[model samples]
Target: MTEIWQQSPDGRPLVIDPEGGYHAAFLPRTADAPRPLAAFEPFVTACLAALPEHQREPGARLGLELFLLGAARRFRHAEPLADEELLAGLADLFERHGIARGRLLDLLGELPALERAQATRQVLDEGAATVEEWLASHNQNLTVRVRERLPDWARDLEA
Candidate 1:
């Protein structure tokens, strides 16, 4: 949720967190604007590098890389790559980094949507098991279209 996109001078997406909430050290300045596909590894490396020595192990690095990738996917502006090209590029990136392809693919599967819905469910409370139930009981307190996605936003909860 903290992630946001900024457009580079060349019009490619630049993912950032303005509040310095997530991995603040690596925020790109104007001079460092990256080419689209080339941006992923360098950003991940910088964020991982910012962590203390005790936390710089391979597994931790892989997890952070995946989490950042998910956030970037959620916020990055539209680009022209075809689906196959994008996936292939990602797969190559993972291969180069020693991360498993299956892990990358699994991370890509509706993870961001599920994460948002899960957060909303927590905000609504444990007893609120469905979107309809949540809305019906509390609809008056909020604005319209705030959660118009309905069932999708509450997908993590039981019906």
Candidate 2:
């Protein structure tokens, strides 16, 4: 059965199958317009690069879920979030997954520009600002600091 994921009114991520019943699962809502798989590649690569060698594979999977949750939240709002609000939501997500906020923030910083832009655009294309543009305009330097700390293993999605 094809399942459609969406955030419910209570802010829970839910899956609805073709029959229109909500399932007990947390699935990120798919974008209204499908994007290339490549749009997600950078997030996957960043997850892999951020995780320690012993937990790389599982970490990547969890990281993708966390990233998608953020995206879904953005899409639900149909607008850009204030930086503090975004970080707080992410912190809650990471806490639920037993990840430290600092570590998750570090990983987020490592995410490539292409992936960040794609995700931001996917949710806020109709808005005047892109994700990068918004960050730039606000002089948000946290993501930039993370970028500077990327390890050699971190791959660029654009490549």
Candidate 3:
């Protein structure tokens, strides 16, 4: 099947070649799309659901990276996002990613959305920690932790 997310907003074709390696343009989505971070929720949910049974490290890591990068894109936009709207969206985004998704939904149920990304980068910056960094220096114990969290497919990656 065609990649659902690869279709651009205006319907232009978008190509993402996993083999080509790191292409900046291939980020989660444009930094300015409407509800971009929130858009990641479903994909995150898929990852969380698939991880325990899927055993594909690359898929797991890619899922997290794509979802977070999508969130990061939303955050990176220069335009102002309402704090309440953004926070709500972020909570929704996280809930979508969280395995115990209900708690996040409940916690965010009454809160105003957060827009901390534009107020400062500190919060959004936290999301910038990359899989590469996580994998590179993790102590053997941490490595095991990372391995457990990752889909089995990602284990053989060379970086």
Candidate 4:
């Protein structure tokens, strides 16, 4: 169950471990391994592309995109990027997907970041003006479960 991943009938890799949870496998890396933000680009792109033209729940689709955005920023292991740079990157990503900066910020403002941060034990900044701020405040907790949820998100989009 642990040594090699078995292929399912649908050709998906499956493995079982004591935790009984899904996992994403990555090659082992040394302590100083470089994990650049670019590493998340393909997954983010594919996740977005998988979304149907007419979503049953547009809000959920937006949430999934937002999560992917935060994941892209959170996964980079080097020195933290500046807030301005991160904000610009976020804006660019959304804009590329046809979501305007103003619209995205409006959605961010509506999210209960403080409550979620408190619930998740992330750094609770009472006023997070943008998604980057919220994500930065919750980076640690956000990164911990990222890989596990990625395939789930893709499946959700396909569904």
TM-score of each: 0.37, 0.31, 0.27, 0.43
Give stretches of model 1 more than 4 Å off: 1-36, 50-63, 74-79, 110-159
Which candidate leads in lDDT? 4
**Which lDDT value does model 3 have at 54?**
41
Local error of candidate 4 at residue 106 (angstroms): 1.4
Q: How would the candidate models be sorted by lDDT, starting from the highest?
A: 4, 1, 2, 3
lDDT of each: 0.40, 0.39, 0.39, 0.43
lDDT digits (tens) for residues 67-136 of candidate 1: 4464334323334565544555555555555555445554555445644654432433321232233323
Tens digits of per-residue lDDT for model 2, 1-159: 454454333354444457764342333324563332233233333433434543544433343334444443443355445544454545544444456544554445554443365433332231222233332354434333333423221322112
Residues 1-159, candidate 4: write the lDDT tens digits.
464454322233434457755321222234574433444444455445545542455534554555654454454323366654444455555555655654554444544552353321121121112234433553433322333444444454344
Q: Is candidate 2 or candidate 4 better by TM-score?
A: 4
Runs in model 2 lying further than 4 Å from the true structure = 1-59, 62-73, 113-159
Worst window of 10 by summed lDDT in candidate 4: 119-128
* Descending-TM-score candidate ranking: 4, 1, 2, 3
Query: After superposition on all CA atoms, what RMSD does each candidate show versus the true structure?
Result: 16.2, 13.8, 15.0, 16.9
